[model samples]
Every structure is written in structure tokens, then in C-alpha cells.
Target: MSKILIVEDEDAIRRVLKKVLSEENEKFVIDEAADGVDAVAKIKINNYDLVICDIKMPKKDGIEVLNFIKKFNQEINVIMISGHGDLKTAVEAMRTGAFDYIEKPPDLNNLLTSVRGALKAKVVKSGIKKNKSSTKKGKYEIVGESKKISDLKDLIVKIAPTNAKVLILGPNGSGKELVARQIHLNSLRSDGPFIEVNCAAIPSELIESELFGHLKGSFTSAHKDRTGKFEAANNGTLFLDEIGDMSLSAQSKVLRAIQENKIQKVGSEKDIYVDTRVIAATNKNVKKLIESNIFREDLYHRISVIELNVPKLDDRKEDIPDLISFFINLISAQYDKKNITINEKAIKKLSSFDWPGNVRELRNVVERLLILTESDQITDKDIVKFSGK
Candidate 1:
């Protein structure tokens, strides 16, 4: 049911409008405001789908009420009730954010039609807002029972709802990008696009064009119009992986983009607006980079609203069992084999060694074990031979 507020000083007209609205739609929950002051108070305190206010009121006029409501809550749909002689005010009210206008001696069909149309518009607007918010959320799913993994998951849940920029720090195979994805998935903009750019992978010369885009014929190889990552991720997220390796010049542009929420294409004179949530990840110590004068201090601050440190494989050895099991299942399905079980001795042997490449390395070992082990049940000797334990 949609909530609606009716604001009019006269009790007779207020009651008549309420009755007409109620009679027209049984689903509408109608509330009455004696004057503009009361209407503004109700609008602030309650969530109303629509507000219908008379042009002239005791404390404040309909125009004031309309302007106030729009400034406070742009989502609320409003309809202005004006006297026959107040047609000019009614039109002005529409320009001031009123959904529609109706003459004071209200026509039933006109009032009903306007109310229905306003409600429909409100619904459509609300859907767009919801979708925009969803796009900013990232997608990351890491299942584990280890305390470190569990704590990371808890942290992500707490931080994802906010608009804070995050910097994920971890080793190359420690799933830093996964954590970044999880943060985006949980954020308000999850429904928006999740654009990933590997800074280290892009060539230094082309990094600017890749990130901020460029106009056609701006450069020798420029063949067509292109939108940059920032533009593509408008109202969404931009994940910068291996940020520590980004070139100094690119760092300057990135810093500007983060600070201004705007980007200028490499060859274009025009600046494009972007509402993007930034999630940066790096395997190297950004602090060390800053000390070495490789990373920009200003850019680091711009992206690090919150920092998440992903634990390495050796740091969380207790998780080996679960990780091993997960990989076994994953590889078993890929190799078209029945779910295989590993012996306790084999798990112990696997857990005893230091995983230099972290979870990714462990997964490869599991796949190797699956391929080499002749029996359905993997033994310690098989793990030792295949994993080179």
C-alpha cells in the first residue's frame, strides 16, 4: 500500500480530497495535514509515496511546501491543489517539482488520473534508484571455516554497506581481488558494474587511454570513440588490481579521478562525470612503494578509506583441511571423477608444508593429487610424491 499525505488548511476540502482519494484507491493509506507546517513535519517524519497540498495555507503556502519536500526528499511525488484563478501558481508549482496540478473544486477523474500517474512515476523512480545502488555492490564468495577467513568475511559484511573506498593488501595468490569483489558485492552499488583493471598489465603509454578513454583521432592508433573505465563504471565500481605497479603519470590521473569524481579522456577536452566506488588491491607493500617514491601519497590516501589485509597461506595453516577439501571437490568435478577422500596422514602431510603460493598453490597441488593418485582414496605417499612435500 502507498502512503499519501493531504495538506490543506480547510477541513472541508481536506476531508473531501481524502475521501475521493480513499474511494478511488483502497490500497492508499491517506494522512491529513492541516497546514503546510504540519505537512512538512509529516514529510520529514514519515515516508510518503505522494503528497497533495492546497496552494494557499495558514502557516505556509503549497509552493513553499512543495519546494521544501523536494529539497528534503526528491523521491516523493507531489500534486498541487490550486483555485481556478490560481492556474499560474499551479503551473509554477509543477516547475518547482510538483508532480501535477488540479483545480480546487476538484474534478474526480482528473484527480484520480493525476494521483495514479504520480504513484506510477514514484514507483519507476524508486526502481531506478534501487538498481543504481545494487550495481555498486561487488561479487565475492569465499567459503572457509578458518578464523582468519571468518574474520575477513565479518569485516566485509560490516564495511560493504558503506560508501567507503577500500584498499586490499595481500600476496599475489592470497585472493586480494576476491576480497575486493566481496566488498563491492556488499556495497550499496552492487547492482552497478564491477570494472576490473589490472594496472601492472596495461602498458605505461596506453594506461591513460585505457582508464580515462580517448576521443577518436586523438592519437595515431585511435580509430573510434571509447569510454574509459571510470565512464563505464558510472554509478558502479572500479577495481584497480596491482595498483602498486601503476605508472606515476597514471597515478596522478587516478588521484584526480578519485578526488573529483570526474575523468577527462586522453585526447578529449571534455570532462565526464562518474559516480564510481573505487576498490584497489596490490600484492606489494604500498607503504614501501611510497617510501621508494614509486606510489603517490595523495593517491594512496584518496583510495584507502578502509584497508583490508588478506592473510597469506602460512599465516592461516588451520584452514588447510577445508581448503584442501574444497579444491578436491572442485577438481574432482572438473576431471569427471567421483568425489574423492583424502586420508588423515595425507592431510597432515599437506598441512605441514609451507604453501609459498598460498591458496592458489594449494589448489594446484590438489589437482595434481587428483590426477596422479590411482585409488579413489588419496594416501600420504601420493600427496608427498605429487605435491613434492
Candidate 2:
């Protein structure tokens, strides 16, 4: 059941909100508080999913309560209740971290809608956070018995036990990230956090603040203090995916962190020491980038103490059958469908195709086949039709 707190000084309003929410959703356990002080006290003890707070109250106001929630539990959604006079204050409450505001004499429909949306968002963010923490053994398990795979597994074992930084090189979707995770899982920091950052996905301006945190009020949108990836992955592994696409400025900050074992947050001067293992990956060329003056040669040398390469899917066609079987079982369970069998002819057709998108691409094709196939078994015609280049 989801817990919610209703903070209003007026007893009638608080009682009405409690009744409305309870009638709307019997699962929501709503708690009422007459003042901000009582509200903060209850919040300290209970893990409330959502908080509906009034702006005006005796002793401690909604702004103070909102600020308190932002500092202690940033995930909790707080919705402000504003009177006609409190409209401007409600707008300010948003900047201070309240999720959204509803004008006083709350509209039942609008209130329910905001509450439902906030609770849904909370569930999604919570699920994503937990999904990031996977078991050590299963997450990095590589399938197949081909010579190329065997050689790669052997290389992983050799480097997994070391503290040296590793740089993975490969074509797009060729399992460079799996190699990085395997190294982390096999290393001494297996029990610690395995934080993965896609350098290419982050915007150029905010990359620094992303890797190293920023303080509240550091910028226009920095309403609350945030923790960065480096700090999050302390005493653990930090996987920098697509390092080739990172900005030159961000690269220099990363170099300092790797070299000195310390990082400074974007708006702070204090250097924080982080005992993190760096594993960087990219499909771009270090030599060409260095020659072009886009990438720093010194940083490349710092990150590439142990270099490893992942082969393309087309180069490992012998493993396609095992990969197909693995995907059938995994995808069937995920989608709640029966696992389909593929004949030798179908396997040959899949193996014959040039998988330019590599292992990642193969998985997508398998999922598509699983969802679209008419029969209980997969065939060459299915492969030909669904496995489009």
C-alpha cells in the first residue's frame, strides 16, 4: 500500500481531503497533520509516497516543509495547496522542489489527477533505481563455445582479477559493455555499485555536473544538491560507455579523476577522493582522434592500461545457434510466451546474414521473431521475413 501525508491547518479541509482520497483509492493510506511541524514529524518517521501540503499555516509553513523534504527525501512527491493570495508562493514552492501546486478549494478531479500522476512517476523512478542493481553472476554471463568467444572469456579472466584500468574497443553493439561488466563482476569490487554512464547520451554542457555532482543553487535549475556518477560508484566500478563522444572539457576532468583519484564537483572547489575503478569503452579510434587533436593522448594512455577488443557478430557466426536458443528462452519468459524451436535451415539463414548491428541487433531480431511468429516453431521463411537488414 502507498502512504500519503495531508498537511493543512484547517481541520475541515484536512478531513475532506482524507475522505476524498480514501474513497478514490482504498489502497492509499492517508495520514493527516494540522500543522507543518506535525507534518514534518510524521514524514521523518514514515516513508510517504506523496505529500499534499497547504502554503499558509501557523509556526513552520509549506515552504519550510518542502525544503525539508527536498533535503531528506528527494524522491517523495510534494504537491502544494495554494489560496488566491498564495498563488505567487505556490509558484515559488515549485522552484524549491514541490512536484506541482493545486489552487486552494481543491478541485477533486484535478487533485486526483495530480496525485495519480505523481504516484506513477514515483513507481517508475523507484523501479529504474532497483533495476540498476543486478546480481553479479547472471548480468555479465556470456554465452557460446566458439573459439572467438572462448578466447575473449579467457582474456576476461586474466584481466578481471587486476586493479588496472581497462579500455574496451569494438564496433557498435559488439558487446564492449558486456566485457566491461564482466571485468567488474570478476574483480574485487563485485559487491560494490556498477554505475554505467553513456557519455554520448549526456549533453555537452551538463556532462561535468553529471560525472561530478553539483550543489543546490549552483545554476538556474539546480534546485537541490545532487550526487554524481563518480561519487555513486565509489569503491566500485564506473563504466564510461561511448567515451569517444565525450567533450574535450569533460575528458580533462575524467583524466584528473583517474590520475589523482579525486574529483571536484561542478560548482565546488573541494576535491572529493573516490576509490573507483574506471572501465572506458568506445567504437572510435584513439589514434585517429589524437591525430585530429580532438582527444587527449595523455588521457587515452591513462584509461587504456589494459586494452581489449570485442569481435563483431558476423565474425562469430558459429555462435549464432547458441545465441538464438538463449534468446528464445530469455525472451519467452520475459514476454510470457512459449519458447519456439528453430530448425537447422532457419539457423543457417540467420547465420548467413551480415549482422552489422552485432549481438545487440541480434537480440532485437529474436524478440521480434518471438512476438510475430505464427507457429510454435521458427523457420527459414520467418527468419528471412523478420530479420530485415
Which candidate leads in TM-score? 1
**TM-score of structure candidate 1:** 0.65
lDDT of each: 0.81, 0.83
Global local distance difference test of model 1: 0.81
| Model 1 lDDT tens row, 1-389 | 99999998989998998898889888899999999898888898999999988998887899999899878988888888888678657656754557666666876755775677678767756765432224333224574757887777767765564445678988979988888787777555667898999998999999999999999999999999888998898867899999999999999999878755678998877877677778899999898999999999878866775678899999999888988887887789889987689999999999999988998898888898999898988999897678865
Backbone collisions counted per model: 15, 0
lDDT of 2 by residue, 1-389 (tens): 88999999999999989999999889999999999999999999999999999999989999999999989987788889988677557656755656657767886765775677568656744654322123234756777778887777776754554456778999998888888888888665777899999999999999999999999889888999889999999878999999999999999999989756679987899988887779999999988999998899878877776678888888889999999998899899888886578888988888888898999999999999889888988898998888774
